[model samples]
Target chain A: MKTEKTLVTITEEMVLNYEVIFGKQNKLPPTFPMIFYRYINVPWDYKTAPIHRKQTCVCHSELSIGESYHCVVTLDQVKQKGKYMFYTQSLVGYNLEGSECFRCVSELVVH
Target chain B: MCVRISRTLTITEEKIKQYAFLSGDFNQIHLDQKEAERYKFKEPIAHGMLTMGLTLEIASSFTEKGMRISTYEMQFIKPIFQNDLIYIVAKKKKQDYGSIYLEITGRKQNELVVRGELALERLSSIHFNNATKESGM
Candidate 1:
């Protein structure tokens, strides 16, 4: 399943809070986009949220404060093995120009 | 890969809760002991993303203008329980054409808990790909 596009904006407050929590690193943390994961995760029907087992994030270009991005989340695969269910999902963000700015692939597990 | 640095920190409940609030990951498994038991974990476990964020802290020390990461990948090999002293090591793997690669590993004492790698470049330019400054990157 794929989610409808969601617009995410990087605000000054967000950048400030992030820098305060993580560090004053001039570059945006790659995992910063994971903050919006919950928006697209609304489509899942699980009674409890799945465990985030692993993650892979890639940044294709620089993202600045005040920039807005369009994100789409896709449930890439699901497998059931006896008492366990494994889910793979990808959340991709694109700049207004439609260039892929960043992407995150998450592996989740539910029992 | 030969050059390396290491740091350690004890994961605290306060830190975990702080991250959950910031990230909007209100998973019970990360907050309640009972919920963690359901997953066969002892006590509550730190969110993988929280550790992932902390992992990048070590990587940031290697940066001058900060990091424009090409990739930040991590695997939660084992549950990181609160109070576990996490030892993190980062190695400079290689660099070429403005991009640098680093390998990182996290251990809870003697056992490996997380392993990852980062590909980074200086964050000085918004146009990341250009052969020259005047090419309109």
Candidate 2:
């Protein structure tokens, strides 16, 4: 008789890939998934079933994935400069370790 | 030496949707109002990266010709919702060697939303000039 065990290691790489595929297609904001995964302990590659299922919006109670839901990547830079800058400020600060996970995900996804 | 600056921003549904497309995050808490309410959020919230990235941008604006951000650490204290008017406050905290340190905070009215620290590296002005020249900016 042979015994086999399964070991699961979830990395930023896996999350990045998941976002690249299913994430890009939906109208979900970036922060939602980041926070969602932060608290959930399930492997992104769990073989049981699709990790994400289509769900209705709680606000309007709509389940449609319409063209309006699609985001325009080209507009991101504009959005950042215009709307984002309006609310934030620029400064200099000491280095810290809180953003390590963010850096890993950024390097894996953006670069 | 804390040098601080502040600005105001209004989170919009369009911006949230745009971030969703760029980052591939469609969590209902940000898209569906009901979902957000169910999750105990006042409304659909802005992405944390959106706030963080904007903070970095603010830092970059204060940098000299060749200076660049080298590292940062942030903690989210509150959720930022669409249509909420928020303020971003950045402060220059310290300077040592060739690095400049900063502290950033985001506030909605009187509520604290996000806060963090960052470090910027000072590069040779020549490098900055050369890069700008090469890019033709």
Candidate 3:
């Protein structure tokens, strides 16, 4: 079977669901969703927000917050099989006050 | 393909929950040990991003000061269970025009868990300049 990729945006409702799942310990950090377009030609549809200075966290430094601006990107991934499959192809955060380049982190999960 | 550094870490259920708290990824396969077993995993596995973050941390340590990662790509080969002692190894693969390329691998004992690449560039040359220019610095 051919794999399919789709971009998903975490809406407010999804965040609320996460809160429901996490219950009392529901301190979910905001993250910008992005895709590594390897061999696809798809137009960027997600609206880009105005860059504003704010404190943000990235990857392993999740506890030590730093200054940054939010950038949202749409992600496309191969359709996963089974109930427990999730692939976080990349995780990135850009420094608002320091640099235009963003820090990228990547990983995958299959069940 | 030289210059390699490795760091060891133990993945715990609490740490996995912490990652889920940060990333908003509360997948039961990663949070519930019983559910994970039903799904065929021995136990709740750690979030892939958590492992990726550690890999990036190791990669960042080898680069020059002021260098920032621009691109990171990885592939997950196996599930990482709780308390698994993971060894993250990063090797400098190539460099050109201030861009350093690195190969990263995560292994549990002799078993490969994840593999990927990273691209690093000087912060001052790339986004830093633009940020400064925008700030009229």
Candidate 4:
């Protein structure tokens, strides 16, 4: 199991940029977790790279701008199905109080 | 108990590129035509989250009064090729206490591409507005 962590902050500019393209909303978009992907830092083969197949996000608290989050991504499990490797990873965010603000579990299929 | 809204969206390469840079996925399957052709897809695919983000925007519109998302789950049933138009729909499931449930669906060319469920927590209008106003939203 590989675990990686990074501090993520949602700046006003990011929200503005997203809103410009996706439209403005009262709350940060659920896709806000995407900011954590750069920290994935994992290497893979493009010819047989993992493709996103499923996602689940549970929000425990509302995300406010300027909130610093400790984001963590971990490889939870892997299964080989014929010619594909189904990998499941858990992504979570914690607020200053160390309380879970959100969790997103992503399943990727690699050929 | 039942409500529905639908819209047609055309996702462009420029849109996918923006998401790629923001998310930092850079899987090549989502960018780089030559690299993407190396795979079985033979064409670039949009990020799954990009679609999810759009879905959320739709839900947010429905809850502008005071509701906020609580839980969202999505299944990528099929690959959505870039520059293709996708039809999205959101239907109200039910409401319990201070929460409203919704079922979301996305399709490309009449083929189901993604399906998901969304739950929104009902908050006081003033409360929700106050939270967002802090950011000058």
Across residues B1-137, which tens digit of lDDT does each residue of candidate 3 receive?
Answer: 46888888887777777767656555687888787877677888776666665455575453436565555666667878988998988888898876787788888889988787776666455555456677999
Give the DockQ (2 decimals) of all models. Answer: 0.63, 0.04, 0.07, 0.50
Candidate 2 error regions (>4 Å): A1-102, A105-111, B124-137
Per-residue alpha-carbon lDDT of model 4 for B70-121, expressed as tens digits? 7889999988888889999989888876777889999888899999999888
- Tens-place lDDT digits, model 4, residues A2-67: 455678887788787777657787876455776666765543332377888999988777777788
Reference A-B contact fraction recovered by candidate 1: 0.69
Estimate the TM-score of every prediction.
0.90, 0.52, 0.59, 0.88
For model 1, what is the C-alpha lDDT against the true structure?
A: 0.82
TM-score of chain B of 2: 0.82
Interface RMSD of each: 1.8, 15.9, 12.9, 2.4
lDDT over C-alpha atoms for residue B104 of model 1:
90
- Candidate 3, chain A: TM-score? 0.27
Which ten-residue region of model 4 chain A has the weakest summed lDDT? A38-47
Writing each residue's lDDT as its tens digit, candidate 1 over B1-137 gives 36798989777888788878878888988899998898788889998988898778777665655657778999889999988899999888888777788889999868999999898876554354633444754
- Candidate 4 Cα misplacement greater than 4 A, ranges: A39-47, B124-137
Ranked by DockQ from best down, the candidates are 1, 4, 3, 2
Q: How much is the lDDT of residue B65 in candidate 4? A: 75
Q: Which ten residues in a row have the lowest lDDT in candidate 4 chain B?
A: B122-131
